[model samples]
Every structure is written in structure tokens, then in C-alpha cells.
Target chain A: MKKLWWKDKFNIFMAAIAYLTLLFIIAAIGTVIMKGFPHIGKSLATPEIQFAVKLSLYTSLISTVLCIVIAIPVAFVLARVDIPFKSLFNTLLDLPLALPPVVSGVCLLLFFGTTAFGAWLEEIGLPFVFTIKGIIIAQIFVNLPFMIRVMKSTILSVSPRLEFIARTLGCTPTQAFWKITLPLSRNGIIAGTVITWARALGEFGAALMLAGATRFRTETLPISLFLNMSTGDLEEAMAAANLLIIISIISLYIFNKLGGDFIGGTRGV
Target chain B: MIKLADVSITLGDFSLKNVHLEIRKGEFFTILGPTGTGKTVILELIAGLYRPDAGKVLINGADSENIPPEKREIGFVYQDYALFPHLNVYKNIAFGPRLRKMPPSAIKENVQGLADMLEITHLLARFPGTLSGGEQQRVSLARALIMKPKILLMDEPLSALDPNTKRMLCGELKRVHEKYRCTVVHVTHDFNEAAMLADRIGVILKGKVKQVGVPREVFERPRDQEVKNFLGVEPLKAVYAR
Candidate 1:
């Protein structure tokens, strides 16, 4: 079919914006790659760099697991249950996302610094003050909302009638959830897990304030990048940045390959 | 026997008024209504999916309030054939029996028997997404029937099929009913479908059951002018003459 001139103009306008956005992203990534690709292997030779990579991976993995454990039930409740003050709870769940990372870190620090709950946690031998454990806590605090939002939307997209059908076919509520809803929303959950892991991997301000970038102790990839750059170690800093970018790209690739639609303002599962 | 003793429920804009219905065991009872008449609500309430705001739903003379749908031994088939897309047809049909902890041999026999009956034996390995609408409906019917529910509730199960498929499935439904004699409450807006299958009809309009009688009585001798108009029939006097 032949297209009209105005339609062609509109198409060109949209394409131009899209290409401009793509060019900006590519240029930024290319700048980092050109500088850091040569130093990536060399930077790994430093024990601090090794510790940062290992710490980031371990904490992010642990936080993602924790997020999934909490998000499943929370997402299900948000999607299905008729709880009192539901909108209030939803707003509170998303409060961390609205706050700056530094503010979130400050809030966590205050709550766990000298409160009764903090004393109890310390007495129970799980002190979350400038420890690897604290790093995980900060990561979880920042990433939990992302996982929950993704999972809740995904579960909502599935008709609750399907669960009702399972119940009628002789399944209890829990049984129906496990056998039907979980499998149906598996891709979305996996996508959420990947996104959460990526976000946690590059978490900087909260991890810096709460965990305190101690060398070989609580330093993560982003914290390591900052610390190295401050010390005039540009190569090490760029290597860390490059590593984070590569991991995020790989995570997104896996997410898309597994049939996970983008979550946020974009269309999603 | 299935009884709704003045069951009523109101959700959002849709409401079911104080409605009473008694469907005898082994009878093919059809609730005929237009869209937005709360027909599906009645079925869900009977299946124990929705708790009625008032009144009682009794199965075999016992209140089924505390009984869950699965424990109530009621099977429900939705309009869209809600087969679990993650499972193949064989697994879908076997789901109920597996939940009941039937032995492997028994589950295999039951699934195979239903597959043969529905003539979906060759389609067992296929997923629901691959099957035609008619095939999915047959599989859904088999899934519900394999549980051997004391009462089966179907909500416009054939509405999505083509006319030819609908006719074929209607015959299959009748044959299945005649053989099993398990009580059936089928909901549909199509009077012709009700006429072909229902042992008795309950005409529901605006959340209330206006008439309950055999098809001939309801169609030929509508209680009032409203029913006559809703049914889109000639005047009652002319219907009687024909």
C-alpha cells in the first residue's frame, strides 16, 4: 500500500527520536569499552578488584533470592487478596523507589543504628552495620520493590479465573497457586529476578552509606569503581564500570530470550 | 440434588437477587439468560467459588458452605475452556485424579478412558494452544468429567465454537449425560441450545428467575408480556394456537 506524505513524516519523526536515543546509549558504552576493555584482565590481578567482583556477585545473588521469597507471597496478596488499607501498603512498598539511594541508606542506618530492633538483631548475632550482611540488606531494600511490582503486574495479567478453575478441580488455594499460578507467571518472576540482580549489582549510594566501601570487606563493584577513581586509578574504575555494564546487558538478554517483556512504562508481562 | 435456597450476591454493578432453584439429581437443567444477567454468578455460587451474601446452597440435602469446591465434588467448565496452558492435554485430564492420589495405573486408565471417550486419544501429547476450539472444549469436558463430580456446571461451554462444532458437541454432551446421569446445570443465552439439551429451563432476566418450566411450557406459555417480549415470541395466544 502507498503511504501518505504526512504519515511518512510522522514515521520519520518517531524513527529519528529512536535512533538518537540508540546513538547516545551506544556512544556511552563505546567510550567505556574503548578505555576499559584493555584493563579488564589486568585489573582482575588486583586482590581488591577480585574481592569487589566476588562481593557484588554474592550479595546481589543473595538479595535477589530474598526478594523472590518475599515478592511471591506479597505479589500474590497485592494481586488477589482484599486487604485493608491496600493502597497505603502499595504506596509504602514503593516508597524506597521514590527516595534517593542516599536517603534510603540514611533511613536504613537510622533504623538499625541504636534502636531496640537493632539491639535485638545484634544480640541474635546478625548485626547489619558495615558488614557484608549490611550490603545484602541494602541491596534487598532497594530491589524488593522492583521485583514485587514486576511480579504483581505479571500475576494480575493472568486471569484469577484460572485459579478458580483449579480449585473447582480439587485443589486448595495453596495447591492451586503452586500448580497453576506459579508456573504461569514463571517467566515474569525470572525476569524480575534478573532485573533485581542487575540493579543490586550496580547499587552505589545506599551500599556506600550503609556498608562503607571497606577494602576487601564490604566493597561492591560500584563502590570499588568510586574508590578507585578517587585514588586516581582510572583504569581500575573503568574496568569495574565495564564489568557492570556487561553483566547488565547479559541479564537483559537472558530476560528477553526467556520471553519477559519490559516492566515500567514499557509494555510488560 | 443441588439447591439454591434464595441465594443472593451483589458484586460491583452486577447483582443476583434472591433466587431459588432446585435441580434434581441426574437432570439436565439449563439457565437461559442474556448477557449481564448474573448467570455465571449463579453457577459460581453453586460450585462454591463465590460465597452468597444470603441464603444457602445445598448439595444432596446438606449445606455446602464449609465444603470447598473440590471437596463438594462439583466440576466447573468455563466459557473459554480454562485448560492449564503449561500442561499437555493428557496432564490436564489427569490433574484431578492425581490430586486425589489415585494410583499411577488408575490415573493412566482414567485419563486414557476419557481421552478415548472424547476422541482425543491422539491429541493427548498436544498442548491446549495447538488444539482447535472444538478440540479444546472436548478436552475441557473430559477434564471435568474425569473427576466424576457429583454435579457438573458448565457456563456457555459451546458459545465460542462454530455452528457445526456446536451442533456436534451438543450431541456429544447429550450422549455423555445419558450415560453418566450426573446432574448438569448448563448456562447459556441461546434458547435453541437450551431447547435441544435442557430437561427443564430456568429463564433468568435481570438477576431474577422469571420462569421455571419445561421448554414447551416456557416458550409456548410465557407467564407475562415481559417474558414474551424477552423471548421475542408472538403473543401468548398465538403461541398456544401454533
Candidate 2:
């Protein structure tokens, strides 16, 4: 018989702890499915739950596209150039990520509700307070920092020497970016897009604060779940919660497959 | 013709001060220096990649202050062979001509010609990541030469290759310069490279061009004590010493 060493005992203890955590996770998710599986079909037949699903998909798609369009150049500038107050600017960009989603929602609500600037925006035919557009705005505001953070690291992994070589091949700076840097950053763009879309799809507290919990109007999936649970409609709430759980599981699986293990963007991108 | 008239630049911890040099048309000139002596910086400056804080970079007797790198009509080969990993060898060589909006037939002809010349025609379909170090070196040469720039600047192009590959590429480099007859400015730390390829050599030390002469002259008689010590060949008569 082989003798067990101290390291062997330590390894077994750690492995046991990890397995326990995994077991608890499986139990929690399994119970949610068992409670809600039968009512999901009934919930889907209802118009209110259907509206929530459609609204969530529509708003998240738009916000993800907007974030990508805005994040690329901002990330490029942050990663490539030596701008004034770069560290300070980076910290300011990250503040949204560090703060709670509710705080960002409150900040947005006050700025767009009480100020003359908000009134001016309203006069110009763009109103954001408690509207569907407000949901999209909150999503963008919440997820832009994560998208930019991923993109900046992605841009850093590509060497500037490739762009310099492109210039020698008759490419202007803009042309070089399109031909060289952008092509090299295809994986990073995909990773950034996937993570942003997932976050936007599930944004809850900020959407509730900024877009309001109005049924059939600003009702997203999480909002639908919140409203049904609060009104003591356990069957409808369970169905909505189950739908969210399935989506969350799928998105997380995709993110783990496509994105890096950590938030520092993909390696060798 | 290229000339740097009393050029000086200071960036962060590195500085190049009071550097003056001239290269005649169609001449193969080599700038020889030890590591981190800013030899590559000089090549980049000549290629319009950098601007001197104090003096003008004159290309064909015109001040290069307004010339961006794209419009400078200069080709640069980097030490690391920075071929675009996303582009195959054919597209890599054809990049410049396509940008010029040359007709497809002409672009194909040009790409094939340079690839054939560099002996990389077989690797045209393969991306840069698949190529060996020597193969990448040849592909990079083809990529730059495809532009047909009047001035070709190389920065330690052979440093990354193995010893055997370096010797072979060094001979090919001379042959390519002769065939193209473009004004060549090659930077390297090896004394043997300058001795073999340069019509004239500039020895840079401590951010200055300490001596500019034919290889024989510079090798036989170094400028000062620092250069004499740096070249590492004692000027002594063995019989007299005995």
C-alpha cells in the first residue's frame, strides 16, 4: 500500500471543498427547474410574458451594437496613444463598473429628470425617462465599461510594429488600422460583443430604476420576473425565472467558451 | 540620396544628439553600432517614421518634414520580420499595389515577380504564422521590395536568423541590392556584415557617429580611444613589442 503524504491530504481536502460547492450549485439550479418546468409552457402562452421576452431581445441587441460602435475607437485611443490624464480617464471610465447598477440608474434618472439639459433633450424629440429608450440607455451606460475594458486589452496585444510595416506598404494610418489592427483583433471583437450582449440581456436593477417596472411598456425579462413575484403570482413568476435561468446558463456557457478565463480579454488576440 | 543635417532628438530615457550623415544615390551604406546605440532609430528617422527635434531630414534634397510615411516612397524592413499574420504571402506582397489601384493583371504580375525573385512563390498561399524564420525573412523582403521604393532601409534584418541562415541571407541581401540598385541603408551590429556589404560604413557610439569611412579604413584605424577600445582590435606590431 502507498503512504499518503501531507500534500496528498491537503489536495484531498481542497478537492472535497470544490466538489461540495459544485454539488450545492447543481441542487439550487435543479430545484429551480423542477419548480418551474411545468408552468413554462403556460407562461409562454400569455401575452405579457411574450412581450417581456421580445422587449428584452430587441433592447439588448440595439445596445450591444451601439456599445461596439462606440467602444472600438475609444478603446483604440486609450490603448495606443499617450493622452493627457490617461490614468485618471481610465479610472473615470471604470467607475460605472465599480459602482452598483442601482447607483448608475439613480444618477441617470436625476440627470434626465430634474435638469434643464434633460428638458432640452426632450424638446429635441428625444425623451429617455421611463421609456423603452431609457432601458437601452441604462443598458449602454452599465455595460460600456466592461466592453471597453476588454477591447483595450485586446488592442494592446497586437504589436504596433505591424501597423508601421503597413504604412510602408502604402497604407495610411486609417487604412492600416482597417487592414492590420482590425483584422488581428477579430477574436477580441467577438469576445467583447458576446460579453456585452449577455450583460445587456440580463440588466435588472438599473432598468427597473430608470425604465420603471410598468407592465407591457418598459417590461424586460427581469422586470417581468420581479412584477410577477411581488404580485404573488408564483406560477407566472416561476416560469419567468426559469426562462431567465436557462438564458443565463446558455450565455455563461458561451462566454466561458469564447471569452478568456479572466476579464483581461483573450490571450494571443 | 538621403541626408540628416545636424539631427537631434530626445525621447524618454533615450537621446540621439548632433548626428550628421549622408548617403549617396544607389550606394549601399551600413550603420554599425553595438546594441541600443539608436542605429534602428536612425533608420526609422530616414524612413520618415520619426521627426528630429533639431534638424531636417533631407530626401533627394527636399526637406522631409511634410512627408508622411505612406507618401515618402520609402521601404523599411524591420528586424522582427513583421509580416501580417492575417495576410498570406501573395496578399502581403500585393498590399501596396492594390492600394495604388493598379489593375489586377499588373498587381498579379508584380506579386508573382517579387515572389519569384525572393523564391517565395511556393509559399504565397500560406499565412505568415506558418512560415519558418528564414522563410518569413524572405517574405518580408518580398513585401517591402514589391513597393519598389527608391530608398530601402533595413534594421538588423539578419539578427533574428540562425547562424547558417544569417550567412546565406547576408549574401542574398547584397545580390538583391545589386539587382534592384535601390539606395540601401542597412543597420547591424556585426562588423563582418559592414565589411562584406557596405560601400561605406558609419560607426555610431554614445549617440554620435564617431567615424564614417570605408570598412578597411575604419577597421584599420579607429577614430579615438573609445572607438579603438570598442572595435576591440589592438593596433600593435608583434615583432616590435617583443
Candidate 3:
């Protein structure tokens, strides 16, 4: 059957919007690749750049792992159990996502940098100001919301009846969660972890404010890009930007591959 | 024996008020009610999944207020089976015994025996998602049976099956009940299911037990206007026509 003009018009309009969005992304990324490809050899040879890359990888990995560890229980509680101030808890948890990255970093600095508790922590040898630990702390603070959001939605998709069945079969509440709930939410958990890692990797303003963009000390990939660009070293900055773009594309690809089912809701029994 | 004495609970819009019931040992008790009448709530309460807002639930003449579902030695089968989709049939059946820390050898023996009894030995390697409704139903029964629970609670276990599948499984259910003599409290909206499997039936409407008696008595002679109206709409014999 021949389609109607009006019917095809809506389809064409939607396609136009999608293509326009894609065009913007490709243009933005194409400029960096064209400019940065030639400088890749020199940019990678720098000790400072290498240090930033290594530090970013390790810190993001640690923070992502920590986010998963904390998110599992928090997601389960939010998904399953009832609490007194649940709305309050949800609002507080989501506040980080709403705040600007720089503002969040400033808030973290005030709380953990100059406070008496921060002093006590320093006394115990765990400092969170202008250090690698500060970078990790900031990454976790920024990425935790993504972890919780994905994990909570995934946990909610799994039926509580499965846990009830487990409990009836002589497994405790904790056992039920570990055996049934966790394994069931595996796909979502993986997707969440990848998204959290990607978010942490791309974190910049927070890392700069909290860790202070040092030369070879606490510099991350984004910090490296900024520091290089500040000295009019556009090639190295573009190189760093291209690297970030490549990592992001890879992360996004993995998320899309694993996330179709995660977003579609729970797997069928 | 299983008993609910003055049990009252308010869940969202539904509330059960001063409910009382007595189910004897080895009896197939069916709580007959329409959908959304809190039939599953009663089963959960008996299984210790939900605590009653007021009064006591007594299992074997002991107050079960403090006992958790894990310690209750009960088996619950949901309408949708609630099988672990990640595990194959073998692991799903063996989950309970493994959780109890039983030896590997004993778990294998118990699971194998139950699988044979339920005629699901061929489905042991398949996942629940691949199985037909009837096959999944049998696997669910096997999973619950392997635990050898003191009481088995089924919440519309066969309601999701087709007519033929439902009929076949109902026969299997009767056979299993007769062989094990496990006290079962099966809740359903279908009166024909209650008539076929129940030694006694309790008419529940809006979380209230209107009548409790043998199937014939509950079917032929409802005690109250509400029970009469509920059963009056659909005759018991007509439900078995298909």
C-alpha cells in the first residue's frame, strides 16, 4: 500500500530530528579527531599525560567498585523495604545529580577539608584534600547517583515474590537477596557499573577543585586536557579530548549492547 | 493444624477484620474468594511472609508471631511460579536444600526423586523460560516439594495455565497431596478447583470469611447473603463444563 503524505511526514520529521542530533555529535567529535590524530604520538609520550591516564583509570575503577558495593544494599532497601523518611532519603540521594559538578566539589571540600572531622581523619592518616584519595572521593560522590538510579530501577523490576519463595524455602532474607535478587539483577548491575565508570572517567570540574590538577600528582585525563590547553598547547589538549571521546564511545557501545534488556524491564521466567 | 485467630491487617485499601480459621492436619483446605479479596494475603500470613496487624497466627497449636518464613518450614508457590530464571531446572529444584547446607549428595538425591515424581526429569536441563506453562508448573511443584515443608501454600498456582494444562496439573496436584498427605492451603477464585481439591472450603469476601465447610455444603448451601450472592452468580457444576 502507498503510504499517505501526512503519515510519512511525521516519520520524516522524526528522522530529521534524529539525524540533526547525530550531525551535531559527529561534527563535534570529527573536529577533535582531525586536529588531534597527528599529535597522538607526542601527547602519549609525555610522562604527565601517562600519569593522568593511569590515575584516571585506577580511581574510576575503585570508585565504580565502591559504588556497586554501596548501591547493592541501598538499592535493595529502596526497592524492597519501607523506611520512615523514604522521600527525604530519595531527595538527598538525588541532590548530587542535580547540583553542578563544581558546586558539588566545593561542597565536598568544605565538608571534608576544613571541618573538625576532616582534621580527625587527617590525624588518622586519611586526608581528602589535594590528594589521590580526594580524586577517588569526588568520583564516587559524583557517580554514586547513577549507580543507585540504575540499580534501584533494576531491583524494582525483579519481583519480590521470588524472594518470598526463597524465604519460604528456608533461606533468610539476606540469603534470598544474594541468591535470587542479585543474580536476577545481573544485567542491570553490569550496565550500571559501566555507566558509573564512564561518568567517573569523564568527571572534571570536581576533580580539579578537590584534587587541584597537579602536574604529575593528582592529574586526571580531563585535568590534563585543561592544564595543557591553558598553556596554548592545543594539539595535546585535542589529543586528550580524542582519547576521552574514544573511551566514551566504547563505554556507550557496551551499555547499549547490555542495556536493551535492562531498560526493557526484568528478564522473563 | 493451622489456625488464624482474630487476625486483622490493613494493607493499602484492603483490610481483613478479626478473621478466624482452622485447617486440620493433612486436609486440603481451599480459601475460595474472588480476585482482590486478599486471598493471597491469608496465605502469606500463614507462611509468615506478612505479619497480622492484630491477633495471632497459630501453627501446630503454637503462636507463630515471632517466627520468620525461613524458620516456618512452609512452601509457597505463586501464580506465576516465581522460578529463578537465571538457573536451569536442576538448580531451581535444588535451591532450597542447598540453602539449608545439605550435602551435595543428599540434594541430588532429593531433587532427582522429586523430579521423577513430578514427571519433570526430562526438563531438568531446560530453563523455566523455555518450558511450557505445564512444565514450569511441575517444576515449581517439585521445587516446593523438595523442601518437604510442614505446610504447602499455593497462591493460584494453576490459574495461569490453559484449560487443558490446568486440568492436568489439578490432577497431578491431587495425586501429590494424597501421596505426601501434606497439609495444603490452596487459594483460588475458581469454585470448581476448590470443589475438586478441597477437603473443606472457606468463602472469603473482601477479606472476611463468610463460610467454612465441606465443598458440598459450601456449594449447595451457602450460609450468608454475601456467600449466597457470590456463589449464586456462578454455579459450581458449570465451572467444570470446559
Local distance difference test, each candidate: 0.89, 0.87, 0.88
Alpha-carbon deviation at B221 in model 3, angstroms: 1.2
Q: Ten-residue segment with the worst summed lDDT in candidate 3 chain A?
A: A260-269
| Model 3: how far residue A211 lies from native, Å | 1.2
Per-candidate TM-scores read 0.95, 0.93, 0.95
Give the clashing residue pairs of candidate 3, or none: none
- Candidates ranked by TM-score, best first? 1, 3, 2
Quality class of the docking in candidate 3, CAPRI style: high
Task: Give the per-residue lDDT digits (tens) of candidate 1, residues B17-54.
Answer: 99999999999999998989999999999988889999
Chain A, model 1: TM: 0.92
Error of 1 at A4 (Å): 8.7
In candidate 2, the residue pairs with backbone N, CA or C atoms under 3 Å apart (3 or more residues apart, or in different chains) clash, namely: none
TM-score of 1: 0.95
Q: Candidate 1 on A139-246: residue-level lDDT in tens?
A: 999889878888898888778988998998889999999999999998888777887898999998887777787877988999999988999999889989999989
State the TM-score of the second chain for every model: 0.95, 0.94, 0.95
Which residue runs does candidate 3 get wrong by more than 4 Å? A2-14, A260-269, B233-242
